[model samples]
Target: MVDALDGRYPRNWAESWDRVGLVLGEFEHAVARVLCVVDCVPETVDQALEVGADLIVAHHPLLLKPVSSIAPDTFKGRIVHRLIRAEVALFTAHTNADVANPGVSDALAARLGLTGLRPLAPAEGAAAGGGRGAGRIGELAEPLTLAELTALAAARLPATAGGVRAAGDPGRVIRTMAVCGGAGDSFLTEAARAGVDAYLCADLRHHPAGEHLANDGPALLDAAHWATERPWLDDVAAWLRAEFPVDVVVSDLDTDPWTVHTASAHKETHP
Candidate 1:
């Protein structure tokens, strides 16, 4: 399993600041059932336990930041302890997975039915060695209005309370599409240069999104960060299942950190 991971995702692809690869547990441990998730949160951990998962393959690392201690006193610390106690291995593929061919962003573009897809911003090292990078730009099968494109994205990607939000003229026609799995504010200029008519991703803040829209950039469609990355879990699981003697399960945890609700009002009985 480790060999497969290393083969498909070379360590050199990882960024200098990233903590990719295995973050917990022994490499040779017997993994019966594995769970694939975007984020290694409490809900995902519970799902792994419920499914009797022996290992978890996640996109985002649980230990991205420095930790002074792991005493189980804090939330992340407690999760680490629980995994160790249960003998569940935790592995993550962050920026490395982002740069791989058919990576998270590519998978997302495929889900949206985009074609002729290519990396939005090809990584520096990747180009020299014939490798792709994070984010993807592609063409839609048929052109649609900005609002229609937003609706299509909401329906295609996993549905959540924060299904989809757009930041362009609803009547504007959309042909080319650019996408990044998670927060993609940095790639706005790249998408514009690629001449994409629409850009879909997650975690688009007020000012940045507003600025891009006002600048006549690509029509933007913001979705739940978790929802956008969740689709790649299946791709990762499929690769692991084909290469190892382990079972892989996709976690259905909504770890977007957003709680959506609508309010209602009562009617008055006055004439």
Candidate 2:
């Protein structure tokens, strides 16, 4: 499993601060049942235990930062103890998977039925070519108004409490678009440079988004971070099942952190 993952999503492709790859367990242990999830939190861990998963292949790492201890009393430490006791291994494929050709954004783009795909920010060195990069730019099968595209995105990507919102003219037509799963405001300039009609991502800050629009960048569609990335779990699961004898199960749990969303009180009453 580790070898296959390494070959497909090499750890070297991850960013310098990213703590990806195997986080726990002896990799040699037989893994007949595997659960793929966006986050490896207590709820997903419970799901893994309930499903009798021998290994947990998560997108987000449980330990991204240095920790002094792993005692059961602590929050993450408690999960560490639970996994250790249950003999379930944990592995993470974060930025590496994001940069893979048919990667996270590829899955996101596929959900929107995008065509003629190319990297939004092309990579450098060994992983440069072969469609490996940060985000993706592609032509929509057909053009749609910005509002229409926002609705399509909401209908296609995994449903989240926060839903989807757009930051451009509701009637603005969109043909080509760029997409990056998770927080992707960092690529605002790249999307602008590509001159796509729109860009879809998550966690778009108010200032950055407003500024991007001021510069006449691509229209923005911001969905929940977890919702944007959930499609990749399905893609990775299909690949894992095809390549290995393991039973790959994708988690249905929504771990987006934002559980409830509603219009502001003023808007609720005034509108």
The lDDT leader among the candidates is 2
Error of 2 at 163 (Å): 0.5
Worst 10 residues of 1 by lDDT: 123-132
lDDT string for model 2 (1-271, tens) is 8888888999888888989888888978899999999999999999999999999999988999999999899999999999999999999999988889989999999999999999999877657789899999999999999999999999998898999999999999999999999999999999999999999999999999999999999999999999999999999999999999889899989999999998876644453
Model 1 Cα displacement at 249 (Å)? Answer: 0.6
| Candidate 2 lDDT | 0.94
What are the lDDT scores of the predictions, listed in order? Answer: 0.86, 0.94
RMSD (Å) of each candidate, 1 decimal: 3.9, 1.9
Best by TM-score: 2
Estimated TM-score per prediction? 0.93, 0.97
